[model samples]
Target: MPRPGARDPQAPVATADVSTAAESMPRGQRSAARPIPALTLVSHPTAARIGERLLLQGLLAGREVALSRNAPDFTRPGEPLGLPLGDPFLSRKPVLFVPVGEGVRVVPGDEGRCTCAGEPLHGGREFGPEELARGVPLEFSGRTVLLLHLAPPPEAHAPASLGMVGQSAALHGLRRHIERVADVDVPVLIRGETGAGKELVAQALHARSRRGGPFISVNLGAIPKELAAAELFGSVRGAFTGAQRDREGFFRAAQGGTLFLDEVGEASPEVQVMLLRVLETGEMYPVGASRPVATDVRLVAATDADLEAQIADGRFRAPLLHRLAGYELRIPPLRERREDIGPLFLHFARQELEALGEAHLLTPSDPYAPPWVPAALAVRLLLYPWPGNIRQLRNVAKQLVIGSRGQSFLELDARLAQELRLPQTAPHRTPPPGAPTPAPAPEPEAAARRKSTEVGEEELLAALRAHDWDVKKAAHHLGIARSSIYDLIERSPSIRLAGDLSVEELTLCFHACGGNLDEMVRRLEVSKRALNRRVKELGLVPKDA
Candidate 1:
């Protein structure tokens, strides 16, 4: 019997025959079932040592048997035995043993057609007798049995490239947003802090897009001012000095695919105007060319800088910003989504360690344990401004994994702390105790107490409102854990539940923000995750009422 998961040999052969076979066989014979060839079990030294067993059934009674070192030559029996010989015969199966030889072969008939296919007595193929005598070992299985090799099934190939790794809510939301926009031909503007993996997101969008052309990525800030326009829109020969030949720019190169413009806020006004015209009409005029060339391309622009702020400051064009930002996605900085740092650190460390071929030296525990960044490091990471975001974190992890000879948390933390110029400890300043202590008056004492209470109440109310009166959002917005937020809400008297909000107020805020969560989050200065959780917890249905 064939092994489990093994493909049936007849299936492929039958498919090929059905597709390619000609009409030569008689109709009755073609439809009639042929007797399956007898299966002879062959054992090798390895198989025998492992005690592998094979069971066979359905045999004709009184069939004559002959055994040989190579192929078995069978002859018809002169007399039938009591062991029945009909098609429906049932009886104890007889066990027959043939002499052990270099290999086993079964000859089914006198016509030289062997069950072994005349190929070999074992797993290997047999050549002519002369070649077999020359000690080629008969190209058979010999004393060692081996399994047959089979082809793999066809499948749609997934890209083998690496992508940003992290399943934190922030990253999941970003992935969902990318999926929603990838197939559309609309322009996408990605805004994030530097090192926040904006380029990776752009690449993912390109990979998911239907367009099959080249994905051209251009860093607008990297291009020289004189060559910016020509580089983006292409240039004709003799367009400028030393112009040897006509060159197709990124826009033309990326036809039908995606054109990624990184640091787009850095584009000069002249380039912006040119880009605006190209976006307005799907045509571009090459430098020194009289006519405009029409080209199809999807635009994906990324900027660490705030383009809206740039426009307000007149550093960027407002109209161009609108054209570029057809669909805007903002990637949160690492500091904002500190929950993802642990996974990202491990991902980069493993990648770098593998690249250096020192993967064995670095274990999975290396990134999570002390001497590098301990569990306490999460708090520090949360506090960090992370001006460089995920990119900086990846670089730091790579550096630590490469530089640290001993995978200890303390050593790693010391190195990181020193590099980041963290304070060793809080500084202490002693004041003169002899100096007269300022005594608070009754009115001033009362005012100070009232101010303290007001600050606490304001923060509590702000968190409560941001979370839609759900305790969770209030906690996240305050940067404390969920339990802390719940405790504060339980203690606070001024805060109201989301369900208690007047229908009119809910409708007003929802309409004012156009049902945009990010806008709402920003308006409330609350964490998006917390706000969403609060929305669900509070059972507040969004007002289209």
Candidate 2:
């Protein structure tokens, strides 16, 4: 029997090369050459050492390789090579890698559920140039594995605020993008989900640029609409009712440097037009000033909003977007780059300890050693989804460092469970010998129900109504986990608070938002899909109609 996650004994285990592998395919199919080969192992929970060696030897080229726990049968047609993988969830044959034309196709074997690049492939998926270039991850039996692709190593980049943290290809790719464009003075639009560090990218650009002036950062969304122009372009004495003296605008402050405008999507149409003029003319007129002042500044704008959708809704100016997006850089979300979480957490923890003047508590000999965080804790950290991305990770690090108080792993886990609302995992450190074994406490909601005898659906609905349908608030009120509230909602759709969000209210919000889905999402706190579904269900007329 093959050990768990075993490599093929006969398959040549070498690092997969796209160009070399493509040469083996027929000439007509050579156009499908991928930048990265599929199924490159970066790290494995159990099989890294053996798997890495097996890969170094060689992988099957120009042939189908079936992966399962069963031995290959020589009698089968084509005599397909079989590599056994020891996974409880895998079927006798779970996945098959077939050489198709110029690329390899990944098909499911007669086994457990399999995912290619996070997407379920019921009928299997043939690798396309785009799909192979991205080097999507594969998942089997809750185990994730990175695919190998042969490409040039990314050029080095060292951001001033956030040094290179992970060895993952995605992070490396992001660094390459920054390295290529940092010195360029053209407007760059940095787009990503919130907490993905758009501001850090702006800082990196400024640090890498040739300009010497100070970097001026502004949050456009935070600026009031009425005062946006004056705030961004400066104002002369008596420019407005409260104008006391001449003040330099962000552009003037960033002269010969970078001006990072975050949340640029929040700028009004008038502001967008003003920005376009500034970009075109390299000059701005101060509030109540007749003369245009020439200024030298490189603009870097960032937003989580979808500019294309905003443009379609007539809320964002197309010309401004075109000018701003001279070079677009999208930072991947934390969930997509799980490899970075551990290192980032350590980095944040160090910073937190240093801030608290507890730097000495870390290993006295080696400053880089993780004094508080253990390997098990690190694994747990990596497993988390981190919906809030780096920002949430930093907050968690802060809580752990403070809450742990140089205590045991049990204390640390408890702190994490309380702050992040995570389930407790096995403790890294064992309890003291001869110590009394503590019994597991019941869930907060269970305890509450036991005490008050008010655990019915009516009470749950009442709590949800009291909290405006926020599951977190309702869970807190009922002393239960938020997941329990979600379960309640899922089990009984009719339990939703009446008049909480009526069809008329949704229609008004839709119109009030000018049909901008993102704005509506923010205002109503509903997902885009939910909002769209509700609109269709209500038969609301389109804004265009």
Candidate 3:
């Protein structure tokens, strides 16, 4: 005999007796169990229609089963599930799945009571048509219940950190300068050649200032002239024809924080006057606004141009220069700090690999090794005169990593030179027949012939070149004053010799030889005073030279 609740094999509805008087009962009223077929999980409207076809086929064929309305049991309850429902041509709905079987029981509730005879069955409640169409899931008892899911929300991302990845003396000096001046709120003037990472230094200052507010930056060179004043100082809603709403200036935006003005030398004279006022009074007036607003911003300015020269030329304000340069920090260019090249190269290469999503290729077990660039390459890098400084170095490294195919040192050098537009071999040249070759020019002979005039000149030029033209070092090497070395370079015969060499050339030689006055003195083979006096006499403009 079959069990009391067991399903019958042949009967559409299982019953204890089939001989009851069915003719006396209404057609629709029958003591029979409604057969339920297996549930079909679907994720698309078309798929759900196919399921309906299967369901209707089973129903019309008098198969002893109907479509199941209960939710399907998922293996991983918390996993996301998408379900589709509704008429094929009229409506469509999407439903999300959340696991809820651990602690909660699926039972008939007042809101979802079934009208079927016998036992009441309730597994899931119906959501709104629109909610069901969107597949947003809900969580219950550590399970994700199918609710509705809309389009995925945008992913949040973090800002990239500043790329200061070297620990060379130059970088250390810059870091120390930032730390020392960060707390004081005094205006800082950062000086460096273009692309020498002056802006990075400014960012470091702002990062360490701990000013408790936003760090706002404005590139004075980029702002348009007509909008410059209004942009920096803001404007009232009706200040101009197109002014639709009141705006806050950079000063107000950077309140209680740091405001970095890049290319400060580019500010218009009128803007300079206003800047001086703000620096002195800590107050600013927006365009068309009568009242002044107080600001507690720390000013940090940067420039590649010599503001003093600008002042002399009547292009930059002298008073403004004095006010802005409360504490000046000069960032040495890449050619001046070749010791930082290897480390900076690795840093940039790693960053490039990561950016390309090929970080795994840079691992320790990888076939390619970062080529050990020879001193020849280093010297070349030093001599190329990186007008773009660290930023350019980073770009070159990135290009090499992206384009290089092998680990051979020569290959790396070739690729680097190609990428940087550098020559693979030093250019070969034949000295002109009558031209005095630099090599045959005897330092001692020149010194002896013009002792009174040449001794000081030779010594100064040698010491200056040896120390990479660093005034203090050259002076110390020759036991003289820094000011004295400057004086001798101004009046030296060697000054004329160096006149042909640009400031960049002298600086490159200085850095390439490790800023050693003794090495430079020996190489040039000139007497100390001769070298010293010559540098002083020449008065070489170190900034431009």
Best candidate, lDDT-wise?
2
Per-residue alpha-carbon lDDT of candidate 2 for residues 103-130, written as tens digits (9 for 90 to 100)? 5566777433665433566677666444
lDDT for model 3, on a 0 to 1 scale? 0.50
Clashes of 2: 15
Model 1 alpha-carbon miss at residue 27, Å: 68
| lDDT of the candidates, in the order given | 0.50, 0.58, 0.50
**lDDT score of residue 433 within candidate 1:** 31
The CA lDDT at 59 in model 3 is 26
Two-way lDDT contest, 1 vs 2, winner:
2
Model 2, runs deviating above 4 Å? 1-162, 355-376, 408-410, 413-415, 418-545
Off by over 4 Å in 3: 1-163, 360-383, 405-545
What local lDDT score does residue 489 receive in model 2, on the 0 to 100 scale?
A: 61
Q: Write the per-residue lDDT of candidate 1 for residues 368-454, one digit (tens) a residue.
A: 222233323433433344556777777776777677645433135566865443212221111223557455432211111122223
Best by TM-score: 2
